[model samples]
Every structure is written in structure tokens, then in C-alpha cells.
Target: MAVIPVAIAGAPYEVRIEAGLLARAGEHCRPFLRKNRVAIVTDENVAAEWQAPVTASFDAVGIASDWLILPPGESTKGWEQLARVVDWLLALEVERKDNIVALGGGVIGDLTGFAASMVKRGCGFIQIPTTLLAQVDSSVGGKTAINTPAGKNLVGAFHQPSLVLADPLALDTLPLRDTRAGYAEVVKYGLIDDAPFFEWCEANGAKLLAGDSAARETAIAKSVAAKARIVAADEKETAGIRALLNLGHTFGHALEAETGFSDRLLHGEGVALGMVLAARFSARQGLMSGQDAGRIVAHMEAVGLPSSLKALGLDCSGRRLSDHMLHDKKMDAGTLPFLLLRGIGETFLAKDVDLNEVAAFLDEELRG
Candidate 1:
């Protein structure tokens, strides 16, 4: 097992990644399971394949577990679904000291963590992220949130988990599309700050996707560690240091909004395409070389990820897409901040950007 510590300002946590870690979640969580009643929140898809092993692990540790299964998709991260989860926790009579275990992907982790944060003022929660996307990105950071009709993650909180148990073995059951989509986030870690890691991905990512255990472990550990360092420096996103972590999120979230946050475009898939766009646009602005942007797109395509909006089958013009970004949370005083790159592994937030120019550039990409 590879353990990475996520050292936030006041709330330091750890993420344990390993093959077959799901079967040992009880043992891993034993230190934090102070209460008898544990709430396991998962979506139907994950519950069908992974619930038994997790439940058995808890049972072996002599803990009583109750589950709340949600529908599988980004749609589950909404007011109604959040309320349902909170109500279920209430029905289970979970106390503030008891734990809520998030047992699915980013949706489950975000919703469950938000629910745990709200109930009884603040409750303890553990993240058992079953998807590669969550394992590397969403599951480590405390940025728990649900999407609103207006935009993605419009409603949420900073509720850090007590612990995160990432079982890479669970990823074996994930669809290839999902696996490829998750790789977008793994690549984001390198793009944000680690040039060597970015180069490593350019070489080893294909092997990682091919089920090479060594490559998978290294990718997960490095990605988690990169996020851990950022969260430690800026836990609440008050400092722009953490905002750099949103390398592709602003554009990606806008794309997600344009799709109505539906399955038509998975969050990771949007980020994959968004990162490519971010690099290309940065190069267009003379912030980076166009050749670097081409390299990024080439790597993404090699991994079977969507490197362009055209690949997503979205027909909207770039002006329409820019309109969606207006609702992004990164907007300050009507000016949206973008994490543009100087080159690979070097991204900085550009606050004085012109949305009209962005729209025109996006229009070019859409038409190209």
C-alpha cells in the first residue's frame, strides 16, 4: 500500500492507495471508526460491484453498516439528492462523532462529504473513492460540492475527510472510457507544477492505462502528493496557490454546464478537452509555444481521451460556451480568472483576461 498524507492547514489527512484495498477498508478505517453506526453512501453502479466486499470488511471489524444507494451520474449531486442523503443519515441516527463513508466516485464523495459537513454541524467522514478520477483528484482535496442547475459545484463546502482509502483494484471494473477520462486528472497534476512528471506521463501513461501495476501506483501516488502539497499551502482556496490546481477546471466546468452536467459529457472528459484547449489558448496568447499545446493534445488522444470539443459531439458556438463560463465560480467582479500556462508544468492564473477574445479563440477551435 502507498500512503500519501494530505496536509491541510488544520485538517491533515492521509490517502492510502493499493490494489484490493477495498477489502481492507475496515482495517484502514479502524482508527477513525469510533461509533457503531457507519453510513456507507454509494451509487447503484458501484454498490452492485463493490458493496459486498466493503460491507464484509466492516462486518469483520464488528461495525454495523447502513447504506444509501444513489443513482449513478453527475445528476445525483443536487439539492434533492443531497437532502435524501442527509435524511438517510438522520434516519440512521448518525451522530456527529459517527462516520459517513463515501464509497463511490467523485459524486458520492462530494455529496457524502457535504452531507457529513452539514449534519450535526460537522461529522466525521471517510472517502472510499472507487473511481480513478476521484482517487487522484476529488477524493484528496476537501472541496466537496454538488452541482447547481446554473453551474457545476455551485453549492458545496470545504469538509475534509478523516481519511481516504483508494483501492486501485476497483478501477479494474471501470469502463475503458472512464479509465481514460480519469487519466485527464492524473495528467493535470503534472501540468500544474511538475514538468518532470508531465514528461513521465507523456511516456508512461499508456503503460499505466494498460494495467501496469507499477505505473498505476506511481501515477496515483504522485498525483495525490501534488494535491496534498497544494492543499497544505492553501486549504480554503483563499490563496491563489490552490487555484492553480484548477488548471482546466474553469473551462471544463463551463463545458459541463453547456452539456447540462449530463452523461453526454463526463466531468473528466470535459477536463481532458479543457486542458487541451487551455494549452492551445495559452499558446495562442504567446504565453506558451503552440508546439507544446500540440504535444498535450497528442498525449490526450493517445490515451483515448477527448482532446477537442468536437470529439464530444457538442455543436454550440464558442460564444455560447463563453456564456456558460460567465457563471463559473472563478469569476471575480465579472472578470473570470484562467490558469494559463507558461509551458508544461508551469501554469499561473491570468485575471485580466478578455472573455470576448476567449470566445473568439474558442470559436476558431470549434470551427477548426
Candidate 2:
């Protein structure tokens, strides 16, 4: 097992990565729970595969489990589901000190963490992220949120999980397409500030996705560690340091919004394509060489992830997509900061971005 600690100012936690961590979740989560009974919230799809073993694990440690299995999808991350989770926890009489468990992917973690943020003025929650996307990025950052009519993750909190248990074995159960999408996020850490890690990914990403356990564990540990260092320095994104983690997210969110946040475009898929665009956009602005940008595109295409905008076949103008970004959570003071690359592993927030120019550039991308 690899232990990565997130040292936030007031809420430090550890992310434990290993094989079969799901089967031993109760043991790892034991230290955080305050009672014999724990509340677990998972999506119906995850419940079908992991419910029995996780439940048995808790039972082995003399802890009783109560589960609230919700429908599976990005649509579930909204007001209705949030209300349902909170009411169920309230009915269970969860206190601020008691820890609840969020099992499954980003959707479950975001929804359950937001619900925990409200229960009894803020209860603790554990993230047992089952998907590669959640394991590598969403589960570690302490940034939990739900989507509103306005945009993705527009409404949420900075409530960190009490603990995160990531099992690479979990990925074995994930669909290959989902696994490939999740690889986008793993590639992000390399793009943010670790060129060598990016190189490592370039060499080993295929093997990792091919069910190499060692490769999966190593990648997860490294990604978690990179995020831990950044989160420790900028726990709430108040400083510009943590914003680097959004390397592909700005354009990616716009793509996701255009796709209706559906299976048509997974978050990681949008991000993969977004990073390609960011690289190309950076090159277009003379911040990086076109060769470097093309390298990003080559990598994405090689991995079978989306790397082009025109291929999505959306029926909207670039202005329409950029308009979606207006509702982005990163918007501030009527300006939206973009995560542009100076080069691979060299991302900086450009606060003076012109959305109109963005629209026009996106128009060019759409035409291609």
C-alpha cells in the first residue's frame, strides 16, 4: 500500500492506494468512524459490483453499514439527489463528527461530500472512489461540488474527505472506455508541472490501461502525491498555485457543457481534448511551439482519447460554447481565467483572456 498525505492547514488526510483496498475498506476507514454504524452512499451501478465485499469488510470489523444507492449518471449530481442524500443522513441522525462513506466515482464523491458539508453543520466523509477519474483527481483535492443549471460543479464546497481509499483493482471492473477517459486526468499531472512524469506516462500509459497492477498503483500514488503537494500549498485555490491543476479543465468544461455532460462526452474525454486545444491555443498565441502542441495531440490520438473539436459533431457555434464558460465556477469579476500552457509541464493562469477571442479560436477548431 502507498500512503499519500494531504496536509491542508486544518484538515489533513491520507489517500491509501493498493490492490484490494475495497475489500479492506472498513479497516482503513476504522480510524475515522466514531460509531459502530456508518452511512454509505453509492450509485446503483457501483452497488451491484462492490456492495457485498465492502459491506462484509465493515461487518468483519464489527461495524454495521447502511447504504443509500442512488441512480448512476452525471444527471444525479443536482439539487434532487443532494436533497435526497442529506435527508437520508439526517434521518440516520449523523452528527458532525461521524464519518460517512462515498463510494463510486466523482459523482458519488461530489454529491456525498456536499451532503456531508451540510449535515449537522458539516460531517466527515470518506471517498472510496471506484473510477480512474475520481481516484486520480476528484477524490483527493478537497474540492467537492454538484452541478447546477448554471454549470458543472458550480455549487459545492471545499470540504475534504476524512480519508480516501483507492484500489487499482477497482479499475479492473471499470469499462475500458471509462478507463481511457480517466487516463486524461492522469496525463494532467504530467502536463501541470511534471514533464518527467509526462514522459513516464508517455512510455507506460498503455501498459497501465492494459491492467498492469503495478503501473496503475504507481500512477495513482504519484498523481495523489502531486495533488497533495499542491493542495497543501493552496488548500482553497485562494493562491494561484492550485489553479495549475486546472490545466485542461477550462476548455474541457466548455466542451462538457456543449455535450450536455452526458455519456456522449465523459469529463476526462473533454479534458483530454481540452488539453490538446490548450496546447494548440498556446502555440497559436506564440507561448509554445506548434511542435509541442502537436505532440500533445499525437499522444491523445495514440491513446484513443478525443483530441479534436470538429469530430464531436456538435451543432453549435464557438460563441455558444464560450457562452457556456460564462457560467464556469472559475469566472471572477466578469473575466474567466484560462489555463494555458507555456509548454508541457508549464501551465499558468492567464487572467486577461478575451472570451470573444476564445470564441473565435474555438470557431477555427470547430471548422477543423
Would you estimate the TM-scores of all the predictions? 0.98, 0.99
Per residue, candidate 2 scores C-alpha lDDT tens digits across 1-368 of: 79899998788889989899999999988888889999999999999999999999999999999999999999999999999999999999999899999999999999999999999899999999999999999999888899987889989999999899999999998999999989999999999999999999999999988999989988999999999999999998989999989888888998888888899999999999989989998899999889889888988988899988999898899999899889888888888899998898998999988888889999999999
| Most TM-score-accurate candidate | 2
User: Which pairs of residues clash in candidate 2, taking residues 3 or more apart in a chain or in different chains?
Assistant: none
lDDT (Cα, 0-100) at 66 in candidate 2: 100
- CA RMSD for every model? 1.0, 0.8
The global Cα lDDT (0 to 1) of model 2 is 0.92
Candidate 2 residue 196 Cα shift, in angstroms, is: 0.6
- What's the residue-level lDDT of 162 in candidate 1? 92
lDDT of each: 0.89, 0.92
Find the candidate with the highest lDDT and give its number: 2
lDDT, candidate 1, equals 0.89
User: RMSD of candidate 2 to the true fold?
Assistant: 0.8
